[model samples]
Target: MNRRGFLMTASAAAAGFALAQAPGAAFAAPVRKALPRLKTQQVGSGDINFGYHSAGPEEGRPVVLLHDFGYDIHSFTEVIPLLAEQGFRVLVPYMRGHGSTRFKDKSIARSAQPEALGADTLTVIDSLHHPEAVVAGFGQGAVAARAFAQLKPTRCKGIVAVDGLWRPVPERAALQKDRRGFARKLWTANSPDWRFDEAVFARAAVSFDNPDFAAILTDTPSNAAVPTVSAPVLTLRGSASGIPVDDPTARMIEGAGHNLPLEAPQAFADAIAEMVRNAKWRT
Candidate 1:
């Protein structure tokens, strides 16, 4: 199907499905009063200066939360505190070409390949002096999380991926021509249940203004490799998302959309917590 046709079908699918929840089924929302202000920090990681938000105790079990495409660290604003309360040190980083993250070397290509992103993840973990971390990711961030696990399984305790692991689009030029329009369509199609205001979108949209945004989005590695992930994996999908489930063990978050972290922060954090409790790491 053509792009237009594909989008139409996806939007319809997103609108048609409603989460089948039992009566009185509910999840806890993040408490505003208990939420602590996340401290912003920067780390020099290879070619990139990574800017990230850190929360919870310094010695708490590490949990890295990676945001999806078209979003930044702010995507997990509510979710971070909940994990922190559970004694997990949460680190939400702005991906390359997003927010305050910048490339240090001018000659280096601005690439968002799985390998590049995975390397960045390792840098974050090493910067914190942690042996291993339970990594959680949303959308494109999920791809990164998976990449990190494959690249360095020993350093990844477990993985929580939501609506991730999609193959790259073949028509890169066509999509690159209208990045913003394409992003808007994806938002509407994948999150039909979400009624996000312009203010919320604008907050994340500003990250797109980075000079390397277009280059990173359009860059496609010739050999995009996916090694086997040995770490325990917990896959998730939003009830109303248009993305298909590739993992048989994937759990559906009730009443959520494509932006699972934003729409269901409680469920997202809970999944990470569960992975941390269940996954066994090599000693």
Candidate 2:
């Protein structure tokens, strides 16, 4: 079997083992703290129902959270509360195609390009009624975050990227082996615990079902239409155990990756708080 198949089989077996130990022993769900109330607003002309969970004073400085592809805003489960506790307004939302937010017109191309997403972000920000805010994104969301800053630099105070900055796909010689091998390794590299449900895995498989999906995701970054963003870029890469090593791009942004926000949420929070305090944001 391919690597992904093998890993899923392994994960299923491990999960079974943990379950046998105790219900709670199975891959522990993200902390079960009460979720902040969700607020719905219409952003952009398309009637896209933007959803945001906010915490902290309404008048406090704002920080926006953008998630990765095939991921809902909940990816920030570990980080949002901490930001709110630090006295910043946190807004986490479902991007256009995911969750309850549907495209205003089905005819519109659901292009997942950075520019398209960046525009969607502006609509969401405008709907929030916030004059300006800091934006942070993880994985593919970082692409949109950078685009947003490029498109509306005045509206963005700062940006923090966790596991952001995707390198262009390597040549075939660099792909390790065949497609199956690469897919499995790619999935495992990004998520070691592999806690996704079979249904979720199935959905991800569809995303890759298209012959072009892999190229689209892996190719876009190197050539992503990165707008001229003046906002200070802070990126967080995974450690040796995390994302596949790519050091050159990591150095461009004044940030750290690997065990950054994942292993150290508090440190990440502190760094963001400091960035807000120190940066002379145009927004």
Question: Pick by lDDT: which candidate is best?
Answer: 1
Model 1 TM-score is 0.80
Across 35-94, the per-residue lDDT of candidate 1 in tens digits comes to 233457798747888888888877777899988665667778889889989887788888
TM-score of each: 0.80, 0.65
Backbone-clash count (model 1): 0
Clashes of each: 0, 5
Name the lDDT value of residue 29 in candidate 1. Answer: 22
State the lDDT at 114 in candidate 2.
73
Lowest lDDT block of 10, candidate 2: 1-10
Q: Model 1, residue 200: what's the lDDT?
A: 56
TM for candidate 2 is 0.65
